[model samples]
Target: MNQRNSTQLHPPTRHFSVLLSPTPRGARLARLLATEWLRTWELPHHATEAAEHLVAELAANAATHGRLPGRDFRLALLAGSETLRVEVTDTRGDDLPHRRPATPDGESGRGLLLVEALSDRWGVELGPVPRKTVWAELDLSPEFGNVCSGGSGALLQETREGKKPHQAPPLPPTEPAHSRE
Candidate 1:
């Protein structure tokens, strides 16, 4: 098959990214912007809500725990036909998020738990230097089909109804390593 035909089988992708002050206001704005973008994409209500929650938790975490004076955090949303991936990249590379069981009366430390509950897959990625991206993905194919992906009729369908949730996306591409035989 030609290169164009090979690429056509993949679902169309849409992306939104912004950098904001690492403050409470920024966190709230992250959620609001995400919801608006999803609405523009005509995502289902459940998908939008889940994406909002994931972005809120991630953005709040970045604002609170990942704060570094004079440094801003970035919020990115990658929307595909089958998944919406939310990412908040902060300046704290050493402080990765860890989820622990919270005491019933505890007033804190439950955010990651909510993210875990709402996302099909979630993780953190360390960066070039002094940066870390916390990401979570909500599966959308359960309620909506892939036709909305804005591609030609041909598309990649990830959900199989009874199959398990997809694995987190592979890390950004890297140069291939040559094998020595």
Candidate 2:
């Protein structure tokens, strides 16, 4: 008699993406959606909170600095066994983000500072004509192991099933904000 051992292979990456209008309301919605998704994935509490802040900051920057009339921005979350990456892509390819010291009296300009402090790694990627992506990564704690073992698609399905009462509605598809030069 021969016996075969069983093993299951899981994809190493899980991803979620959405497009939203470049508005303050859109940015707020991005943060809330990210928070809900992270919670659905069952990530560590600290990681979830930090990722929420990162999403808020990056989304706000896209809405404030990278906004183009009639254009929408995209928010994406990619989770691996060891890292979770948050990215916000906008149509403003020429407007690159920079880190600057905030004055004590200034009311704003501290978003990137908070991102730098909270994320394990963060950077801006400019390319593919008329678009730029600002991304931040949080290192997953070993204690949590693989938070997305079941894959993000399943978690998204669960979110859509009204697991939470306050889950945001899905965003509609958007057209290109501007033509390629």
Candidate 3:
């Protein structure tokens, strides 16, 4: 699955995607690679953060739910002027993901909910070869374009300088205390 499904098209100006294996290691590698890629592209921190979460969730789902021996999962990242797209495709067409109601005290379930909240738009694509590509798009605020375009060189240089790519910021703080008036 990590292998290329088809010719990976790298457009001249921007946009790139890579295919990665569907294994747990592959999932981990997807997140790591995405962080580096985003940093190199001078993407805003939020976009990379969302991409990381999406990759982790989708890849975990692929490993735990969509896994088939001898098959591979793929991680694809595409960036445009106003948005960045993250897609994780696995070769599990047998079972599509469903959002189940988690009961009180339930230990698991709720991946798609996070996806819904994080990404501007997301959905699963059933493709030419019975594969499923779950994709999410992160909108790049207008303030980002010039910086990202001009900063790309510096960003790549920073990446080459041995700077470890930064991961997404942690989720917002859970609760606020009530005011004591």
Candidate 4:
């Protein structure tokens, strides 16, 4: 069979999100979970690495500056046609983040710096219950080609013809008990 004529298939990478608690351990888990999830989506090595770094920084910020007693933070990853949006929300509405001068000798204040360098766009959102969400968006179109391990033209054609690609099923809730039940 001619190499050009041989058929190839790759499952679609879909959008998904998750919510985790606001703690140092939670921040670490966020990075690990994001790396695994992105791999399932076929994200390339570079994109996966970038996602891990961004998640770690944002989650750390949430655990440090945005934490409220007994309230947890949330980490969400949303894949789009051309971008991936990473959101980290915490309960401290009063502690809005802003760009400030980092001390030359200080070993702090670099998380936001890293976030700005890695993301295409980022911003903050106010929530319903004195909460705040900080999000960073990363472009995924380029990585998808490498990640899919195939040309995008064919995938586009398939999508144009109204075909749905296979993807991992939604994750079941991690909460152990259902008190209402």
Better of 1 and 3 by lDDT: 1
The best-first sequence of candidates by lDDT reads 1, 2, 4, 3
Candidate 4, pairs of clashing residues: none
Give one digit per residue, the lDDT tens place, for model 2 in 50-129. 88988999999999999999999999999887678899999998877765568999977888777766765666677777
Tens-digit per-residue lDDT, 5-115, candidate 1: 344567679899999889999999988998889889887777787788888889999999999989999999998877788899999988877664688899778887677
Q: Higher TM-score: candidate 2 or 4? A: 2
lDDT by residue (1-181, candidate 3, tens digit) is: 4875698665443565676666778778877988888889887886777778877887778877878888888777888766687888888866667665777788558676666656655666676577877777665663322233111121212232353333332222442211110
lDDT comparison, 3 vs 4, better candidate: 4
lDDT by candidate, in order shown: 0.75, 0.73, 0.65, 0.67
TM-score of each: 0.74, 0.73, 0.66, 0.67
lDDT for residue 62 in candidate 4, whole number 0-100: 94
Model 3 deviation from the true structure expressed as Cα RMSD, one decimal place: 14.6
Candidates 1 and 3, the one with greater TM-score? 1
Better of 2 and 3 by TM-score: 2
Task: Residues 97-141, candidate 4: write the lDDT tens digits.
Answer: 755568999867877777756654566777766898888765565
Q: Which of 3 and 4 is ahead in TM-score?
A: 4
TM-score of 3: 0.66
For model 3, the run of ten residues with the poorest summed lDDT = 149-158
Name every residue pair that clashes in candidate 2: none
For every model shown, the clashing-pair count is: 0, 0, 4, 0
